[model samples]
Target: MNEHDFLLMFSCLPTSNKNEWLNLKTFVDIYNSKHDTNYILKSFPENDNRTSPEPEILLCDGDAKMVIERKVFAFPPSYIRDHQLWHEFHNTFLRQVADIFSDNLYELQIKDVDIPTNKKEIIALAKEIASTVIEYKQEIKNSEGIYSDDLIPWSFFQLSDLEREDSPIDCGVCVRLKISSHFYNNQQLNDSLPMIEAQLIKLLKASAPKFDNYSDCLRILILEPHTKVLNLSINFLSQVIQSIEIPSSIDQVWLATQFERDDEELIRDYYLVVSNL
Candidate 1:
């Protein structure tokens, strides 16, 4: 398999750095803690080319008894598409200027919504960014260590030196660009209800059949969010799941994501969607 495909599919394997691995691990940890069981990773049946409709992950207490089918859902699809295009631009830009910005930690915050889609435009924009970085490298390296510049196709761009004392983590890199959108609320989440329910039902339909072979096992469907904004509420999610039809073979469906507690600490948390118990 190719590197991308392997990384995407085998994320449930032990010690994998992929977010899916984190989702699965978090679910397992929560499950073990809640149930007081010693279930551990058993195997990845989906990787077996010989099998049909295989489970993404299988967990065991003593013998194989639980099956996990994972699906990543994104809302308003455009966000993920734009985010990907940004990464494409990032790669081209980094390749063009990696030598110039060597060994300095930086974060490029962009407020560009109209991101380029085509390869030609992406490459051209990357060049533009490379030039911009070059033009401000001296000022960027100054003691203050922050620069804001405007460019075509982007209204605002800010570069910050992450090596400062207030930096979140010490990324020992020349520069790093982080893309994120933290604008979302319960009202917006409610507005996307129909689309969310439709997409989730489609996923259940696809994954449910895979559990036919594992009827004796505790079947679980994990829906992980791929979009930047999926501020899911337990009450809202419970209502959505109640309106849908989960397959009989699947005993549970869980929405797993990073949860911020009342204490402002972020932890992996799961909310039950469909529970036969």
Candidate 2:
């Protein structure tokens, strides 16, 4: 989702108890309002289901040149008040990962950048991705209690031409394997800030393949539980990119945050953060 439009939605509710937020129709209207009520989307229920369908929460234009998906996750006061939220909220994230890894080439392709040149390798990649999902599930389960004080505990799922087998594509990907806090509490978030600042240096050592043989490509890292990172998300991504062996190949990465608007209830925000760094 676009920042301006999403901010409009977030501004509407501000901060509520989670059960008292605007509906999706209101959100769509608010988002479309900035477009001068362009014919793109008039309203929901009518134009809502009819246009802009991307995988899950993603949105794509007519040409599918750009695909944008969001993870709408916010905690209602009631939901957070009950406690026992750790895995419950994280499992929802795992669900998103499962959905993404299951994507066919068409589902993950990035226009203008990704090419369909290598079908065989693409299939092999998909099969490995599927197995990786199974492996991570067990890993997530096995590593359940352990929390990282410095690292985000992310995973590496894919680094390819948006799942295309083409040899001449420009899409690569990486994964982060932790929830918002990385198993730390409020204090932990505070403590990790400094360490998180050094993420780029860490990623240089992090194991990942070079997508482009001659160089690298457009690398997109979809991170969840971005609610905690906020302004720091871009910095985190920038550092990671800079530390890469060849930073030029990576076009950009997106940080996904699911949050209860500062003021509204029931209306959560699915924010996809894209930065030039």
Candidate 3:
């Protein structure tokens, strides 16, 4: 089932004492029953023991194999931070299982935490995380495909093609545009450039004479994707492009359009073309 269905199913399940151990046990029981699979759930060993416990849940097809860990909690900002106990437990478990599972093992962190208020928000987050995990797993499965290929060399798009020698722009703008082009071509959807533009405009409008360096502007932009800003007029994108002194070349314009289209393979092909040029 999809993430939303999973969440809804989880919500329908009976609530327990809300204790971590108890909640985990309930999940294990429900999951096994629902899937009609033999999944054995075991508690982690105490700190005094030299051997780390096997993962929380083991799914067996023939022998016990797949491992999953459950972390249930109210939403806390520091839940995944390095210093947090949950984070420590997660890292430790991965390290312990590194050799035991060898190649066939999979790790899943199922969290029943408070999600954002938006509709299907939890599902959206879950899907994004799951997609990332699937991508990583696929990469690992195709080890030959990875090691057989040489790394592509980093190359820059030609600014000379812009045909405007006396363009009034900061050197940082050129650098960022080149980097953006590189990422866009490689099918990397980095939401930082537009974000930075918004922040830069805010700061510029606030303090007329004060100038911020490129890195400072970029740092603000890279904070998060501007979902709110996306709903604004097309003029917003134009303003950002103009502020960055981006090239007016037809190729550059077409590349930007490809980014808007969000076709992954096409973007990658564009990147190849730009790199070759």
Q: What are the lDDT scores of the predictions, listed in order?
A: 0.64, 0.32, 0.29
Q: Pick the candidate with the highest lDDT.
A: 1
RMSD, every candidate, angstroms: 7.7, 20.6, 28.3
lDDT of 3 by residue, 12-45 (tens): 1123323434434444454457658665534332
lDDT of 1 by residue, 38-91 (tens): 878877777754458877778899864888878766565564566566668777
**Model 3: worst 10 consecutive residues (lDDT sum):** 268-277
Candidate 2 structure lDDT: 0.32
Sorted by lDDT (best first), the order is 1, 2, 3
The lowest-lDDT stretch of 10 consecutive residues in candidate 2 is 106-115
Error of 1 at 202 (Å): 0.9
**What are the TM-scores, per candidate, against the unseen true structure?**
0.73, 0.25, 0.20
| Model 2, TM vs. native | 0.25
Clashes of each: 1, 24, 1
Give the distance in Å from residue 129's predicted Cα in candidate 3 to where it truly belongs. Answer: 43
lDDT of 1 at 237: 53
lDDT of 2 by residue, 68-159 (tens): 12222222222222222332323334444555443321122112112122444434433444354555544434342122222212234333
Which pairs of residues collide in model 3?
196-221
